[model samples]
Target: MDQNQIPYPGIAHTIKDKKALLARVRRIQGQVAALERALEQDSDCSAVLQQIAAIRGAVNGLMAQVLEGHLREHLGTEDQTPEERRDNLKQVLSVLRSYLK
Candidate 1:
């Protein structure tokens, strides 16, 4: 499959949880803006590093949530046949493992 092509084009499951996800994203965005402002203002190094770490942790948490949703929605409980689900599981796991490294 082409790298540009998403296997699950629409996040049907995610749609139901969009508000929470979007809230998380907005928080991350706000953190990013704060980081930018800190840089512009020449904030203390320790404070900047703390902000960066917080952003990283927040992003990782968001990624984990999305990954769990993708697995559940596309592989584990999707309407596909068992064999198809297995294949998708393998593909998703492979990609996730690669990404985590």
Candidate 2:
């Protein structure tokens, strides 16, 4: 309930999504490390390009899941008061805008 941290949704809603995201990010990190090693080893261009493409696809998938979660849980209509709802919408928009950049 700290002012600096927004409340995350229920464990069932968030944990699974978070686990997936974390796994993808970890894979991306590994890919980046491999790419660096490839560069050090002077790897072939086609193999490097393939790994880069895979990393991009993984990042895009992660972003989609995060955006979907935001729309479903943070911005969805429910029983919130008007002011709270407006605040939620604002926060969601802010996050989306930041990510979209």
Candidate 3:
């Protein structure tokens, strides 16, 4: 794996949660479309801004959900050696740093 890229730890959990995740994505898409329509219709700035904020919050929520699952799934496995677990933790920390930025 490249140093710049952390391995995503939530692949299995994501597969398990695919339907709910997809639903959230679909809702975000709809929010974006609504924002576009608001722009086209010359809606008030406050309303447009509100829609943008809503989309951002929804996206953040989804990210948090996935990150939570990644930690839960990857860090608790009994099979990994201490070194392997440390490496996995480092990967997760790297991702968290980027996400925070």
Candidate number with the higher lDDT (2 or 3)? 3
Rank ordering of all candidates by lDDT, starting from the highest: 3, 1, 2
Q: In order, what is each prediction's RMSD in angstroms?
A: 2.6, 3.9, 2.0
Error of 3 at 57 (Å): 1.1
Residue 67 C-alpha lDDT in model 2: 72
Alpha-carbon lDDT of model 2: 0.75
Q: In candidate 2, what are the lDDT values of residues 1-101, reduced to their tens digit?
A: 43543554443445667777788889989988998988889999998999889888888887788777766775575877887777767666666676779
Instruction: Spell out the clash pairs found in candidate 2.
Output: none
Model 3: CA > 4 A from native: 1-4
TM-score of 2: 0.68
lDDT of each: 0.84, 0.75, 0.88
lDDT of 3 by residue, 25-69 (tens): 999999999999999999999999999999999999999998888
Candidate 2 worst ten-residue window by lDDT: 4-13
Q: Compose the digit string of candidate 1's lDDT tens values, residues 1-101.
A: 75733464466878888998999999999999999999999999999999999999999988888888888887777589987777677767767777789
Q: What is the TM-score of each candidate against the true structure?
A: 0.79, 0.68, 0.85
Q: What would you estimate as the lDDT of candidate 1?
A: 0.84
Candidate 1 clash pair list: none
